[model samples]
Target: MTNKNRNYKPKIGVIGLKGFPAFGGSARAGENMMFYLKDEFHFVVFNTNTHTSRKTGTYNGIEQIVYPKFFIGALNTFYYYLRSTLHCLWDGSFDVIHVFHVDAAFIIPLLRLRYRVVSGHRARPQFAAKWSWLVRQYFRFMEWLFFKMPADVITSVSRPVAELFQTRTKRKILFIPNGIVFDEKSEILQIEEKDYVLFASGRIIASKGVHLMLEALVKIGYTGRVLIIGNRSHSPEYAKELDEISKSLNIRFIDLIKDKQLLMAYLKNAGLFVFPSYHEGMSNMLLEAASARVPLICSDIPENKQVFNDDETFFFETGNSTDLAKKIEQVLSNRPLAVEVAQKAYERLKREYNWKILAEQYSKIYWRLIETKKPLNSGDSEIQGNDEYKAG
Candidate 1:
C-alpha cells in the first residue's frame, strides 16, 4: 500500500453537494480540495444538484457526476444519497469513497463492501437534540448506519463534532473544517470607522438567528445602521416578520448582497461580526469573518468557543438577543480589546482553521484509510435490521 510502489494513481471519489463558484462554504471546500488534488489523484465529484441537470462534463479539470433531477427537501437529499452510492458501486472505478453529510453516510457500508476505502463527512446532527425521544432515536439510527458502513475514517467539520462522534461510536474522527476559496479581496472599503455593525450571512432564516442579531442591536442601542446580508427565501414569512420587527424597532436593514468581494468590502470596516446561529457543526460565515480579521460575537456554543477564547470572543446564550447585544456592546465600546481579540481570533483561524491545514488533514486521513482498510461497526444497524425483520 506504499505510495512509491503503487503504479496507478489512486482513484478518489468525493460525494457531496454542488460546489463553487456556486454557493455555500462546504461546496467551496469540496471544490478547492478537488482542484488541489486533481494533479496528484484521479478525482471525481458527484453532486446531487448537478446530476439533476444531467451534466457530466468536467469542471476545473476534475470529473463531475451529477445526479438525477428531483424535487426539493428530503426527496432531493435522499435521491442524491442513493444515486451517488449506487453509481459508485456500479462504476467500480474508484478506490476510495468520500460521502459528505450523515444522510449519505448511512450508505457507506453497503458501498464499502465494494469500495475498500470509505470516508464520510459528518457536519452536524440532523436534529440537534439530546432529549427528544423521536429525534434521538432517528439520530441514533443514522449514527448506527454511519458506524456500520465500514468507513475507515469519519470526518467532522469541527473538533466538538469529532468528539461527539467519538463518544457515540468510539471511532477515530478526523477534523476537517470547511474551506473557503474567497475571490480576490475587494479594493474598496465601504464602512467608515463609525458605530455601524454587520451581522449574519447566508440564508436569512430563523435557524441563522438573524432576528437575534437585530434584537441584539436594539438591546445594545446601536444607533448606527446595521447591515444584514443573504436571502430569506427559505422562510419568506419569517423574513416579512423580521422586516416588520426591524421597522417597529427602528433598526435599519441593509438589503441582502450575494457578492463575496462586496461582502468582504463591507467586512473591511465593520466593527464586529455577529453570528447568532443556534446550532452549528462549524459555521463557514464565522470562519470567513475570522479569516477577514473581524472581531466576532457568536453564540456561546462549544464549536464557537473552540474558535476564540472566552475573552476574545463574546458569546451570549444561543438565541438570546439581550445577551448577544450585551456581548456586541462590550466589544464595540472596548476598541483596544476589540483589536486584540480580532488579531488573536484571526491568528487562531489561520493557524488551525485555514484551508491549507484542513486540506492537509483530510489528505492524511483519506490516504491513511487507503493504506489500512478497516470498517467500523455499530449497534443501531443490528437493532434496526432486527426491528425491520420482526415487523415484516
Candidate 2:
C-alpha cells in the first residue's frame, strides 16, 4: 500500500499485542481480522520484536510498527503498552483506534476524545499464576478502565467474558468468538495415527494446566509416547517440574512453533489431543485441533463449553488429574467414538467459528461505528451475529 493504493479506505490503527502474522493467541486474532477485512480497511499494526522478531517493515501489505519488548518482572510488558499507546496518541492518520488488552486502560479515555475507540477484551491476565500480586492488583484496575472507559465498541472473543462484563456493568457487550483460518490445500501428513498423546501451548505456563496432563499420564500408567510442544525456556521452573514428572513416562519435547500448518499436521497424527487449559479466550489451539479433525479432549471450562458441547468433544473436570486420566483413557480406548466426536467439532468450527463469518461481523461493527458513530448495544439490538454463541 501506497497513498494512491490507499483508495480512501478506513485507516484503523491497531495497538496492543506483539504483532501480525502471529503464531497464535490475541496477535493471531488481530492478524485474522485484518487479513479477512483488508480490502475494506487499511490497518497500521504496531508490533514488538520480543515476539515476532521480524524487521520493522511491511508484512505482505500491512505496515508493522515494531519495537523491542522487555521483561522487567511483570512490569516488563508495560514497556510495549506504554510506548504503543503514546505512539497511537501522536499518530493522527487513524479514523478508528482499535486497542487490544486491558493494559491500554490508561489511554482509552484520551483516545475516545479524539477518535472512535474499540476495546478488545480477550483475557483476564490477572488470574494467570505468572503475574505478581502487585501486577494482578494493577490489572484489576486496568480491567475496570476497560469496562468503564467511553469506547465506541467493546468486543470479547469469549462469550463468558462478555457476559461477565455485562452482568457487572449492565452494558451491552458484543460476543465475537475466535476463529481459525481453514487451509483448503491442507492435507494430512504420512504420519501414523494413535501413535502418541499430545499437549501444546504458546509457552509452558501454570495456567495452561500441563501438569494435569502429566499427572493423568502417570496415574493411568500410560506408556504411549507423549509429545509436549511449546516454548519451554519461557518458564524454566515449570519446564523443570514437567521434566521431573515425566521421568517415568515416554515423552518427547519439541520447541514451540508458530507454523499453523505444521501444528495441524502434528495434531492430526496424535492418537489423542489433550487441551487441559484452565482458562482461555476462545483458544486458537483448541479451534485448530477441532479443525484438524483429531480425537480430542479439553477441560470442561465455560470458555471451552461455549465452543463445543459434551457431544462435540470429550471433557474432563478442570484441574482434576484423575478425571483427565479417565477421559484420556476413554478417548484412547474408544477410538471410533472419539473420531465421531472430533468430526462433530470440525463441523461446528466451520458453521459457527469460521473466521470469515466472524470477521464480517466485526466489519459490521466497524462500519456502524464509522458511518453513524452510533452505539451498538449488543444487549437489545441485533448487531451481534450467530446466536449459537449466545450465553446460556
Each candidate: what lDDT? 0.66, 0.81
Residue by residue across 1-392, what tens digits does model 1's lDDT show?
25545676778887765543545656656766665666657888777553234377676778777665576664676677778778888999887887766656567777777876545554555544323577557666776677554366666667776666676664556555665543454365575544457775656767677788877676666667677777667577878878876764534555555456666767766778888887776777787777777888888888778667875677789978888877887887798998888888777666565564455555555566577565434422211211222253
**TM-scores of the candidates in the order shown:** 0.82, 0.92
**What is candidate 1's local distance difference test score?**
0.66
The regions of model 2 sitting more than 4 angstroms off are 1-7, 69-76, 186-194, 377-382, 388-392
Question: Candidate 1 deviates by what RMSD?
Answer: 7.8
Number of the top lDDT candidate = 2
The residue pairs in collision within model 2 are 72-76
